[model samples]
Target: MIEICKKYDCVGCGACISACNKRAIFMHPDSLGFLYPVIDQKRCVDCGLCVKSCFNNHKPTFIEPLKTCVGHVLKVEEQVTSTSGGLASVFMREIINNEGVVYGCSGENAHEVKHIRIENIDDVNKLKGSKYVQSFMGLTCNSVVQDLKANRTVLFIGTPCQVAGLKAYLKGKEYDNLFMVDFVCHGVPSQQILNDAIDAKVADNGNLRLVNRVKEGGKESKYTLRLLKEGKIAYDQAYPSMGYITGFLSGLYYRENCYQCQFARRERVSDITLGDFWDRHDDVKGLNNKKDGLSMIMVNTENGKKLMSMCKDSCELVEWDYEDFIKRNGQLKQPIRRHPKRDQFEELYCSKGFQSAIKESLRGDLNRIRKIILFNLIDSTLSTIPIIKIIYKQLKLIK
Candidate 1:
């Protein structure tokens, strides 16, 4: 049996509840509008299968010498929309073209996360980009395993933990038909935070009629929440939605184990690891200025290499030397965690006892702004210094 706190670290990925052979763990929603795990100890044998299955406990072993880029690269020009790069769409398109099924996260009727199966090219839009929250994986792994058993090609995309969990659950099973892709994840945010932000937005407005079309305008445009009173844009405003970015950057959006993630090192379990290629070819003028978007595609296996090669004509592929890749991503040494002062702020929010605590924390608002300016200046200056470059490389252990 497993025990979990209702309000604390449980984002309820359901790995534990799903892993239990005795069916001891079940799902329950707390006050925060998110599901959490509830354990029935009487049926539990204490076999620890749940613990073993938890991605929190079991870290995947990464295999290296994975193929770099040997595929054709073309700049993808299509109407396809995605989180950053449209790589996932491209991958899905190829799979569908070949009559294969693509498995990925989709929002269900209740807006809950659920695994979806797409076989049509037009439906590929459903699975593109990062969802940035816990997805209800459902029994998709079981379905994928069944497909692989029948010699059908399956493309799976998800967070590292979800991928790891699938592989672990199907241990000793080998299938050539499976192609796994994991995001070079920062972390996922809690559903509560998302609900809170949405509620706050609704309250700011009069009615719950407006829906923000995040990707409608452009990538950089501030997200607008539009009020729809009878199928018309009643009121709209452009502002940063705290729910989306805050949970993403703070790692509170991730599973608790993700902070001490064992799979976050050089070697990764997935065939290909994809993420935002933040910096590439700084010495070359036009390459690094891609303010629009680009994918940092890392092929980690022969299968990944083959897929990339097959899709070469669809997208622009650039070969990044290992030294440059490390240098670009190395500055993010510590994964984002709860800020040190966040606990105190959370305490004040909970207790509602001391108004002074909030006042004290907010007293230096101007000073905080000044510090941010200075910090950005120092960061920009250091990034250019030759000596600092040497130190940065050394710190990342880049050869």
Candidate 2:
């Protein structure tokens, strides 16, 4: 009898279900909105087709390095409305203009992130910016396979692992129209955390209504959240906090396999991988002045180079040295901080869910305030050699 573990390690790839010759495997949805495979061991012949077809255990396709590739450091107008550089949107625009469909994650309602297909350029608005959470793959993999079989041009944008899974699922299949783009992902949070955060916000303010999770705000926008309370506009007090970003970087919020991600190596499955150019030194003043940030562009394949060239006019193209780019945003072989307290704090905050986490975050904020006050008092009592000068400068900047 073939046995399968029904735990967190099972990523719900459904390869086992598809590979079962006796048709014993089936997909079952769990409480976390992820689907896992279930098997009827009684009918199982244990032929091992399921294990052989599993992408999780097999080697993925790799693209050979291109001889000559062009790298661009461009300021995208749409990127201002994006979580990172607007390279994904620019790439989608070109693909859509040629009557192609783009597949990516978009916010639905207020909190949910769902996989969507954008054929019309107008529909591109839905796919903009960072969701900060792991998007449900849903039936997208199956859909992409069908679209490929029909000879439709498709541009699939996702994290490195998702891209690898897609290519692995469609192994031995080739299509000229298919393009894959992966992000320089820090990490992804659980979908449950996102939902809980939104729910907590709504519960806190009875009239709080989430308008849109936007990267850009027009004149009416005061903060990230646009709320209607007692016929008055209210915004999220938390803007640009390190909660989500830090959580991702610390790996306190990703899936079980993300920490040991096989896709983080040099051999990438996607044609192009894009990330924020956070450490660029070219005209820092100009780049910083803009509301939207710049992106670190890397063309991993010849096809990526070709696609990037087509969008030269729309973007401010500049040469980015590969060595410098890697030094700034390259993958870490280990966690950011090896201290146990950081991990303990993260687990306490994250596992407590959003409501409890918010309360703890407030306590943290108070602690920070208390430290600032103490530092100021100490500086005032100590010898005055601009002791508190740096702290004052930081406070002014934050304000």
Candidate 3:
């Protein structure tokens, strides 16, 4: 019997499953709904392909970023609607116009997020924004390999572990046409938690048209759930009403591997890294106003520079200090510390469900509601009154 990695070390990227030719490997979910690869001893030939392709077994070397900058889509409407500066949308359009296939995460509703391929430019909208849940990567890596073998241009955008896993699955084959992108991930929660939250909150039996993270004036929100019911806003509340968002922001529960993620550091595994520039707009050189969205981009290779040059006209890019940039984005330096009560949260979740688990786990933090209100007040004040924003920044109160 061949073991890929320990249960806590597996990211469930499915590379081993795709690499196996004899169909000996299959993914089975644990009680917490996180997937892991299982090998069938009867069909195993021990070719070692599975181990060779597993990212956990052969850790890919990390590359320092060649260039770092802040950027955003030039179109106001696009920037306003995007999770950050709409750079991902620009990349998607560029790939589609060149007649390349783009693989990204999309779901019919909140509960079904998965990686899918899209070639048409119009369908790019499906891939926009972030899905808070861990995306299912079922056989998509094989699809990517097939496209690459046909001499077709391919752009894959996913979490860092997924990107590393796909490259591992390719067995050192080089593809000049392949462009890989990953983001500064805020560790993903399981599908079971998301499903339970939707079930508890969405009273109307109507289909969930969509689920989105709400932002205030393009600024990130810590506690908002914007679920659409039949194409209209249904739930727009914060914790303790939104238990999932509460747990997510609290860092109470995540996949076991996320706390020990090897890819969460300054050295990156992808050609390019994209994430929200959390610093104030004025702090960013190219962004003059403080209201709209902005994105932090780290170009890791020549291919990343090529991609950015191709997208030059679609967005504004300005140089930023790499050392200063990482200060705001801690994931660039280290993985999130494992919550002390993480195991307790999981145990409660298995028996009592999402709401009860979150409530009990966060019960000690009585100041949560107060802090949220204060943060919102500061956020609104900073957006509207410039003088107060300066004072708050000087006092080291808000960032």
Candidate 4:
């Protein structure tokens, strides 16, 4: 009997499934639609390859970034359309122009999110924005290995844990042509929740498409989730339709493993890390302070430096202090603190649907609501009082 890592530790990167030569490992969604590996008992030869490849069992080495900076695409047309800074798009384009392949998560439809590969610049648009749900990595790790073996330059962009899983799946074989990039992950809610939200909005069964984290007036709308049915707006992230994003930001419905993520530290597993530069407007010199998106780039390896060099012509890169960069992004310091109502939220979700469950779970918490309101009030007021801004932020009032 070969035991893979515990279910609570699995990030569902599918590396274990790809590492199995006997095809014994299969990924099945749990009650909440989060995937976990399930081995077929009869097909098992006790080979332990699956266990060996499990990122939980074999942790990848983490290295400090060689360079860190705040950057964004110089082209206004491109920056306005991207979720953050448009740096990822620039990197993808550079890779494609260099005759390399790029793999990234794409929302195939309103209901499905999965890893896909692109070799052309036109296809890079599909991989541009943020897909707030977990991406299904269906044998994509194996594809990465194959591409590397064929002497093709490959760029894989995913969550930090996914990068570790791909490295573990290779059994420590180093590939110079393989470049990995990961974001400062805020943890992922199960795709099922997102699908359910879309279904609730588009009850008429019309053709549905999802455009997540839309930009408004050339500025990224961080709280927006848009749905298109028959090419018209069906559900916008307004009052009643805001349940999914609320739950996501509340940290109430992420995968169980996300609460215990080992990759949430400052040290990174990927060659490069990209994320929204949340502190760009916070007294940082030489930073673009516009409402348009900006990215915090961390070059962790020589390959990462090479990739950044390729994008230098198209981006405005400003070096930044790492401590200030990590201050606003909570995911870089530690895993999200699990919400107190997490279990209750899941229970209500199983009984009622996603929207109703969100309402119920978040209801009857006047004290919490009051605190949030008061925190926002003080934080907002600090802008006018400039002197209190530092004091308010240092208090750490509502973490």
RMSD of each: 6.3, 7.7, 2.9, 3.4
Off by over 4 Å in 3: 204-210, 216-223, 239-242, 288-290, 372-399
* Tens digits of lDDT, candidate 3, 153-220: 99999999999999999987778899999999868888777778778887873556444554565555
Global lDDT scores for all candidate models: 0.57, 0.59, 0.81, 0.82
The candidates, ranked best first by lDDT, are 4, 3, 2, 1
**Tens-digit lDDT string for candidate 4 (165-245):** 999998888788898999999889998988887777667744556676777775335565677676688777842233687
**Ranked by TM-score, top first:** 3, 4, 1, 2
Could you give candidate 1's per-residue lDDT for residues 196-227 as a string of tens digits? 44444455433334233334443421234344
* Residue 331 lDDT, candidate 4, scale 0-100: 83
Find the 10 residues in a row with the least total lDDT in model 2. Answer: 332-341
Please give, for residues 1-399, the per-residue lDDT of candidate 2 as tens digits: 555542554555444554455877776644433456676778877787666555666667765334222222254457556655577888989889988899998754335566778899998877776666777665577678777788788999988767866765665466677888987665556666656565655565453333333444521111243444554555453333444333443444455555556565545578887766542222223343233555666677777877877787766545555655555654522323222333444555546755455444443444554576578456544423454555555664696
Clashes of each: 7, 0, 0, 0
List the pairs of residues colliding in candidate 3: none
- The residue-level lDDT of candidate 3 at 174 comes to 74
> Which runs of model 2 end up more than 4 angstroms from their true locations?
1-36, 39-53, 62-77, 204-249, 283-292, 330-353, 357-399
Clashes of 1: 7
**Model 3 residue 233 lDDT score:** 79
